[model samples]
Target chain A: MKKYSDRDSLLIFIVLIFFFILFIKLMYLQIILHVKIDRVVKKMVTKNNIENSKRGDILDIKGNILATSVKQYIIFLDSKIIKDLNKIKMILFKYGIKIKEQKITEFKEKSYIPIAYNVNIDIANKIRSQKLEGVGFDVRYTRHHPEGKFLTHILGITDCCGNGLEGIEKKYNKYLLGSKIVTRMYRDGYGHIIMQDKLVDQSKMCGQNVILSIDRNIQFIAEQELRKAFDKYNAKKAICIIQNPKNGGILAMVSLPDFDFSNRIKNLKILRNSAISDVYEPGSTFKIVTIAAALDMGKIKCSDSFYLENGKLKLGGHIIRDNHKINGTVSLSKIMEISSNIGIIKIAQKLVKKEFYDYIKKFGFHSLTGIDLIGESKGILMNLKYWNHLTLPTISFGQGIAVTPIQMLSAFSIIANDGVFKKPYVVQEIRKVNNKITFNILDNQKLGKRVVSYETAQIIKKLLRNVVESGTGKNAKVNGYSVAGKTGTAQKFDHKTKSYSTKFYTVSFCGMLPVINPKLVILVIIDEPKSNNYYAAAVAAPVFANIAKRTAEYLGIKKDKYEIV
Target chain B: MYKYFLLIILIILSIFIYLWQQNTSIRFAYKVSNLQTKYNKISIENDLLKLKINSLLALEKMYSIADRNGLMRPDGNNVVYLN
Candidate 1:
């Protein structure tokens, strides 16, 4: 053993004291203050990032893309992190982006500055690959409607945040809007970020898709033919709808004066789907309801006769006249064939006022058709208590009553569908992001109520056939198909005059082809045609004929009438 | 003495394995982050290409093209159907 001197002993004691102080400091940092220090480090190195999921698409029945979201980027700059500004400028310039010198100087003073918008994915990738410091990108999705001016009212438009604003887009917004995800990212000293966990599958987080019942080809045909007539007549507005009578699925619906949704809408009123929103007196078309009701209730027989008073009569101090003159007693079929106002009034008198109102409601009037659209009017139907002496008579001829074109078409569809009233719908199915169908129209089809007896429907079908064969709707006849329908020419009610206008008229025609087993129920309406001839027979019937002929040929329906070889 | 030496070696080996696992996990995280970014870029590119295809097949464009090419709709009398 060696003995230590006084100076060496002091040195050893001092070293031991220094080591005791170091141990105490390490204990404080590792135990008592560990939570606080760890929190500070995480705050500096970790960031919260919100990832937006892509919105779902809108497709037609044939799986054609009608509306979709395309990924776009907002190229931005963070002046604090940006190094080598000239290098970024040179690279962006190569991609046809010119940044001003003044803007660059101003950007340095601000932390975040958006440099470019709607930068496509390719250009964004190229800029990102350059690894220019301080350059950042914000992901955005833009809603694009590629079929311009086609199905404008149906496809609708979206806001800047990709929310649907109108039409089908508004009605099915929830299913079309996808969920957003939040993630935490860890950043290193070099500014590179690594996710804390595996990224969630983006498609699984996306919104479900909406599939419509509208066929693009049929829509094109209807739009083309109706546009020609609309331009020729210089009408205020025109609407056409073709529906499948069996299931009440709308094949095509066109409302003219349609604005391209991609462009800013100046007049929002045109955005209204006039097919189901605007109401007008259906004129002779309403006569079908009166006649069908009378026939169904056993108020009259097919062979029953009514006196026509030489095509004119007076009721409730108002004189009504028919366009064609007929004398003495005429058969029930002839009354509908010539659209005799007096004959229809006499037939309506068989039913009480309450009975007529009930039938009208049963035909889906005075209520929403329950269409999958946002803005639909239930139409103007006065309550039964509001009926005066003239109400029943005038409504019987479609003068006092008001209905939307869709309602009138649906009413006629009741006869075509063997008296069963089916609700009309445009959305056919809703599918998940995984292509699994979640909701299908066929799966949820409602067994429609029977509005009239099947026997009565068949008889009314025959009467409508006669109207197109040799009566007012003769212009609606196709060459090889037996047709059934009615023509309507209603005078516009003037608010200023407080009476019907003689100069302005709304002419319309509703018809079905192959009358035995009708495939398509079509309605064409021309409002305020600026022509000398504004009769429904002349204006609306011909348009209906062109659409029917072409549609029939396109659908390849077996010809009902065969010529002898 | 030999038992004590073996115990010390085992403790040292366990620490080494733990450190190696921690380092390897971080490296794998970085690789996975790169792959996720690549996948997102490709998905965006695919969406853009689909939109392009739809734009090309728009009905109005096709109609005008057909009209310019002197194509006419065939009349019912001129068409023959085969079963």
Candidate 2:
């Protein structure tokens, strides 16, 4: 009996040892695999929330903030923590938050609930004053354009992630979107905060700030004058550009029917930057190029004369007529003054089609101005081989081709800058957020290239000055400044009719101040003026005069001659 | 020996305090630099506001303002201009 009992006791001991080993194995697995398995589970269940960085500012030359980002708070609730639901509702009602009891009760089962979004500091302060449990706030940055609708198309706006959607904002998106900061947070088993990371100042991570060449006052004046002209004429659109003739710095550019940057533009057509994006037949404005080409090639002297056909000429199965039909043989100066199509056709007939076409190419037509704006159209220019006899004659009178407004302005700038063609630029400088001026020294200064011969440019300037003083552009004369410019009244082609429309015309004027040594070049275009007087001299030239006068006065440019109102 | 040890301890404490103050000043300088950027932005905004006000009061702008806002001359005789 004793031996049997001893054997049974030993079996019991063995079973007890087996059970102890199982418990020890479970403990080992829990200790060794706990962290790894838990990490995977947390990743699957908990979402990693990302905080978007605030967008950098668009500033004026003087560092005045044109656009900026301000901090706003999103009010949230963890309804599970609300000890008194009715009290919380009452408190929210006082702050104009409108939190319903039913919604709060429903949210009690959830971990978190969003009550209000995008509230400013004042509203946030009021909510915080209540000191209610379960109430929380998450911060976000909202963009504010301080200049209101000023320079709207240029400054542009951003999307939710701070991506520039258009204009300068779109042009320099990579430079303006600052680096985003990422952080991780974890909750304990009870959903209580176990770890938290501090917030980062997004401004520190922001990219370099851009300083535009635009002067705020000049922009204001241009917009004001262009708006007035647009309203007065009841035109479809108006465009004006003010540029520094020295280095191609576009000081001010306005394309009316311009959209306000802050408001959501309902008509997408208004967002189109007509100045650089739209191409038009330059009409008589292209005469500057024709004459310049003729002068450049030494084919005709400024005093040379040609017999103009009596009011009409047949070419390319098309009839060309002068708005003012002068019947006599006119000098080169007279042809320009009268804007005679026959006179230009007579001269253009002497040159080979390739020479004239090459000259057109040299004038920067059918090319992008590379003005640091996106979606620039390099206007349509037929290849030299594509030019027919008719093409040459028609192109001489500023037809059968298209050019952007910016290209035209750059061409004028070349004439104004003593024949040196400078590439137009909008951004003048870039500086870091700190007080250090990046362009403090000489080496950091910006520079440009020369485009034409100073002598040829001077000759062209003299002729253009005559056009303003005693010719077609006489209406564009400023009282004190010797204005040099050309007037254009081009028929806007109707695609459906496949011919120029009688009623639709683009009337334009391009002007340079102090003609002998020009400082500023201003261009104004009024589209489809309703009044019977749709001539460039009457509709567009006056707008140019007002902009030039106001801009000159604002810039403190001294008048070389006696002034008048 | 004990007095020498105490003196050594005092010197180390003084050195630590001096180093700590220097470190704090460097931090303060960094903060000041950050604040100055914000201040500069505000200063520019204030200047812009002042310019806007001045422009609104300028002769030409004021004339337009008066014309638009219905605050024109009480009578034709009340208007005056100096040549």
Quick one: best DockQ, which candidate? 1
Q: State the weakest 10-residue window (summed lDDT) of model 1 chain A.
A: A190-199
Interface RMSD of each: 1.4, 10.2
Per-residue alpha-carbon lDDT of model 1 for A1-565, expressed as tens digits?
7699889999999998899888899899989999999998888788887876888899988999989998899888888887788888889999988777777787666767888877998888889898889889988999887776898888788887888899988999999999987788887777688555547888899988999999888998999999999999999999999999889899999998799866778898989888989898999989999999899989999999999888788886788888877878998889888888899999999999999899999999989989888888999988899899999999998988889989999998899999998889999999998999988986656688799999999999999999998899999989899999999999999999999999999999999988998999999999999999899999999999999999999899888986324
List where candidate 1 sits over 4 angstroms from the true fold. A1-19, A76-116, A129-136, A563-565, B1-13
Which is the leading candidate under lDDT? Answer: 1
Q: For model 1, what is the alpha-carbon lDDT of residue A480? A: 90
Give all candidates' CA lDDT scores. 0.90, 0.77
What residue pairs are clashing in model 1?
none
- How high is the lDDT of residue A467 in model 2? 88
* Fnat per candidate: 0.60, 0.00
Find the 10 residues in a row with the least total lDDT in model 2 chain A: A437-446
- Give lDDT for model 1: 0.90
Clashing pairs in 2: A419-A452, A420-A451, A421-A451
Cα RMSD of all models vs. native, in order, equals 3.1, 8.5
